[model samples]
Target: MEVIRNLVQSLVIIIILAMFLEMLLPAGQMRAYVKMVMGLLVIIAVIQAVGSMARWSFEEIPALVAGTGDGGGQLPEILEAGKRISARQQELGIEQYRQGLAQQVTALVKLNQGLPLLDVEVSVESDSGSPDFGQVKEIILTVSDNPKQTSPAPGGTEPVEEVSPVTVQIGSSETPEREEAVPPQAAAGIVDVLTNFYNIQPEQVIIIYR
Candidate 1:
């Protein structure tokens, strides 16, 4: 009972003293600092009073209040962790956006049933600070020519053709083999559709035939 009474009296005295000091201080940044300090002092007093009542030693109270323990040392680690989390989230968002864009491209290309679309690849800018961040950089479409095949007569299987390998001379003058080119007329519709719908250039949409 006596300890409680004394604690109450001490708190009242500290509040009254803080009010008096606040009145004497000028209205400026320093006054705000003083008020903060006074508030800390009041908190310390309450903790001390409680510690005494509980018969607990508060020898490290000052260090804890000053943030000189593990709290201060872990500040940089906490900030680094936050940055890593933010970067991972950005990467996930970019991946999801790329996947969704690829699906849309596939759907648009499929609208032209003449072209057989094998796969769709979408490229996007990953730099968050760039002006074109998250924008589609390019679209690559893999397509195949629908070759016509004659059905076997009745139940007879088709005969397979033999492919003979030719020997190459080491010093012979020969032209290098090139990839099969897709006709412009064949891919022009796809390019126009993508360019007009995505607001991208015709060159940005590449078509590869297999």
Candidate 2:
């Protein structure tokens, strides 16, 4: 706006000067040349004003208003990237939650395995539609029948081996002692542990193998 105002004032001054110059010049070819030069100056001034306007409107204005790239601005692209990252983070969080729950149950069960302990594996399930992974909906367990002795590892507990019950030979007879499955009381104890500590329900627990 200021540039336009200055340009307009310059044009007005040029016109006034041309008019004054015309009267001061004596009637001759020199006056004709002077008039022609003044006309060219007027044209140049108008062109300069129009060029500035065009540069501002076509280049600066568009660059400022609309972004140059795919989504009209960098902000939308950044927001989309953030949304993807947030979704991935949520998936990782849910997986970690499930893993943690399974580990805790396994540790607790191993520590409490009764006299002639059974080898056990624990699995936890969460609601598929629930975003809050702490809400455990179901629990599954597998337990071995026979208790195989294991030598302790240097810095960790040794893995238990799955073995069938052995038979002992007596004089004139054979005695086969079959390993028993996990007891009902132990199963109930597992349900109680989850229910009391983790707020789970007894009906939600399933012992697939015992």
Top candidate (lDDT): 1
Candidate 2 residue 52 Cα shift, in angstroms, is 29
Estimate, for each residue in 1-210, the C-alpha lDDT of model 2 and write its tens digit.
776787778778777876786788768878888778777877787787778777655554334434343333455655666666667787788778777777677766666754233333334444446584457777676655544433233477766566665556567475565655567788688778867877777877766653
Which residue pairs show collisions in model 2?
none
lDDT of 2: 0.63
**Candidate 1: what lDDT?**
0.73
Q: What lDDT is reached at residue 177 by model 2?
A: 53
Angstrom error at residue 105, model 1 = 0.5
Put down candidate 1 lDDT per residue, 1-210, tens digits, no spaces. Answer: 776787788778877887887798878778888888878987898788777766522333333444455334354655565677789899999999999999898778667634656678999999999999988899998875432222233467863433435667899899567434445675898888888988898889998766
**CA lDDT of each candidate?**
0.73, 0.63
Error of 1 at 175 (Å): 25
Question: Against the true structure, whose TM-score is highest?
Answer: 1
| RMSD score of candidate 1 (Å) | 17.1
* TM-score of candidate 1 versus the correct structure, residues matched by position: 0.49
